[model samples]
Target: MIEIENLRKEYARGGERVVACSVRELRIGRGEQVALRGRSGCGKTTLLNMIAGIVRPSSGRLAVAGTDLTPLGEAARDRFRGRHIGMVFQTFNLLQPFDALENVLLGAVFGGRDGRAAKSRAVELLEKVGLGDRLHHRPNELSVGQMQRVALCRALINGPELILADEPLGNQDPETGAEVLRMLLEIAREEDRTVVMVTHDPESARFMQREIDLTTLRDGEVAA
Candidate 1:
């Protein structure tokens, strides 16, 4: 579902150029779940952002669902992402002022589905994520688990083909994190969605079928 070749990202740290990722290649197939494991500052998030088309790599190419990401300009990349990519962050990132339903509806807006139907879809997603009862609650009024469920609803509202999660369960307590992860994987599997996740815990990484050691690729090279 996604391919990366000669991907590289560099950053300026302390006035010195540093390579964040120097992966030569990686491929994720449709309906597969891949886990990326690495230490802190191992460039996992950089790679995730690249796959999400939120970052422009210094070199190489990225293709998601067969579209060449590098060639598309930022605007086009964003449009394509809205159509195909769903992202979940460690922090819920929900808008505090908006209720769960409204936050999920925003996903529809990005996909140009802002209408009654869109709202209905959002409601359905919330229900799917077990957030139906909390639809009227704002982020500040919810627990971490509830907020995370809301984020999941928002991410899935637009029917994204590929799911990208960065440290998705890192912030939750062990029990809650397991529940959230189980919920996410079940839905993705049922929908036949491809998922790529960055995680620090080995236990969490084991949940996926494919295991990628980001440190090796970053320290040396990886090929798409």
Candidate 2:
């Protein structure tokens, strides 16, 4: 459900153009789970950001879920992304003052569909992620894993077509991480959505159906 052709991103660093990420052609089918692995600064996150419409590519084409994101304006991109992409950030980007349910409800609000049914779905997703009792709890009061679960719920509240998770299990113990990853995969499968996760952990990458090493992808180079 994702297609990229001649995609490249460059930024001016120290007055010099530095190529961040480049992929001549890449395709991910619907309902597939893929893991992107590489060392720090390998542009894994940059690629994800481009797919999420947070970053504009310097050149080439990008299409997600049949929508060509290259031509969309910022406001349009934001609206499209809000409806089609669910993102679980590495840092758990939750609002400090909002409770778990409210945070999840914001997903529907951003997608322009918030109402009674949306609120009910938010609660159901939070409960599905084992945070039923923590609905009223704010980010500061929740544990790291709990906060991450809440973030996942918020991401899924819109029933996005694609899920983008960056270092999804980066902060938890091994046991907890495994459990969380399994839960994530299970939910993704049940929803029949595409998942592209960025992680440095080899063990975590192995959980995915396919693994891509970003180090092997060079700027202007095509995937053979």
Number of the predicted model whose TM-score against the real structure is largest: 2
- Name model 2 segments beyond 4 Å from true: 220-224
Best model per lDDT: 2
Could you tell me which residue pairs clash in candidate 2?
none
Give the distance in Å from residue 21's predicted Cα in candidate 1 to where it truly belongs. 1.8
What lDDT tens digits, residue by residue, belong to model 1 across residues 160-180? 899888877766788767777
How big is the RMSD of model 2? 2.8
Candidate 2 C-alpha error for residue 172, in Å: 1.9
Q: Which whole-number lDDT from 0 to 100 does residue 211 have in model 1?
A: 91
lDDT score of model 2?
Answer: 0.87
Give the worst 10-residue stretch by lDDT in candidate 1.
215-224
lDDT of 2 at 105: 91
For model 1, the superposed segments whose C-alpha errors exceed 4 Å read 219-224
CA RMSD (A), model 1: 3.0
